[model samples]
Target: MANMQWTLLLLIWMGQCCVIDCQLYEFHYINKEKTWTEAQQYCREKHTDLVTVTNMKDIKRLINISPGNWRGAWIGLYGQTDGTRKWHWSLPGVEFNESEKNWNTGEPNDKTGWQNCGIIWKNLKWGDLSCHDHQYFLCYDDKYILINKNKTWEDALIYCRDHHHDLVTITNMDQQRAVQQEAQFASTDYVWMGLSYACTLDLWFWVSDEVVRYKNWALDGPMDDCDMSGAMETKGNHQWCKKDDTEKFNFICST
Candidate 1:
């Protein structure tokens, strides 16, 4: 009798552990019709809030689950009370982690007078667009294994800066492998990286305020011939160079 009871207890413990380990993360979607306020309310009703991504993997997973037009969904950030344009997550008053705040070139403009709220753009980067714009949004619920979504190089980079830290910087083989796995969905498009020649040093730099730890360039470095004289020149330079924020591309964002 004692042996049988011990066996049953062991089985129960193993089962519980398996159940806990099997919890996977899932991406939820809301149509674009809801205003920011309404979308927030809807998420609350569903027992989840607007999504809060904490890492590159999370960003990718959400993008993969979301469709192209689901751009207008609410995220965790909101305008400050004074309306001076300090954005923050709507969770239980978590401090603004500077390391996680990625901004595009002269972003957070709050172009529209009431652009106090933040939302994910079609490109995956967080932007301070007018709150009234109708676009699909994403929500997340913790489950088992992690999943990531696909993004263009420009959008991915912007998303990383606005939500998480910055475009992923590959330091070593391990980090490279991890980012590659997260970016698997972008097999056709190039995912943006923090590397750029924008600085005086003319070398790559990380946007997260960290030193240049690693680099993986496609042979011969980036070439910049910013001499396109036509209307295209006004847009921005076309460069094989590294770290040009002006160059529009998709990127990953995280908390």
Candidate 2:
């Protein structure tokens, strides 16, 4: 019995150590000017991707990095011309699925032939639009918060990091259910989750770097793709579906 008690204490200590060692994401600013594509390449080769600014904190950090009334620099955001969009979280590691989608009528119609990004309407319906179009976006933090504003997956990631934490990461049924309850009060048809896809890795992971062990995919299964993120239906079994990361939606965050 004494030995078992010691083992339990050791395990608790190890868990605490892990928590202490977990570091929040960092940002690096490159003063050199470059196009979006060039900047992405530079960031990938040097740091991570061209600074995925997730929120006000990141924006401020970026400003502090230079500490000047500078104009602007290229970020990780860019569009694809190959007609194949690669879905990715503003935060890294999260994966996207193609099967889960909630598009509005005639969505992705490419009305102007340049519709390559995604957006969420006030009603929470998704639609494809031009990536060049400018709109307020969302970002994720490492903390938790329930934001009522609409934003794309990448934007949501930045927002959370700036305001509270990253988007909420649900690793268990209890967490999922709690988020589902939060969804009940959402004004939209669904709420954005911290879930996203990494096209390069071809896998899913939470922005918080948690393992993708527990899942709540819908009965129809999830769609796989490079341009989608995970979202929970406000009304159904709370099953997750795929959505274009560019699509805006209210999101939850956690620390």
Quick one: best TM-score, which candidate? Answer: 2
Q: Which portions of model 1 show Cα errors greater than 4 Å?
A: 1-24, 68-72, 81-84, 142-255
Give the per-residue Cα lDDT of candidate 1 at 170.
40
Tell me model 1's lDDT, rounded to 2 decimals. Answer: 0.48
- C-alpha root-mean-square deviation, each candidate: 19.2, 20.0
Candidate 2 lDDT over 1-255, as tens digits, reads 111100001011112335322323334434453444454555566544543433433355334444243334344433355557554433243233444444579875778987655544434345666655543232222223468999999998899889876787776654675477567667777788888888888888788787777899888766779988988888868788888888888888765
The digit string of per-residue lDDT tens for model 1 on 1-255 reads: 111100001011212334222223345665546667776776667644666644555565556655444434567667775635466775443445657765555667878677776776656566776667654555554221112444544555556656654555444443444344334444224445555443445444455444544444445554543311000011122112343344444443323
TM-score of each: 0.44, 0.45
TM for candidate 2 is 0.45
Model 1 clashes, total count: 43
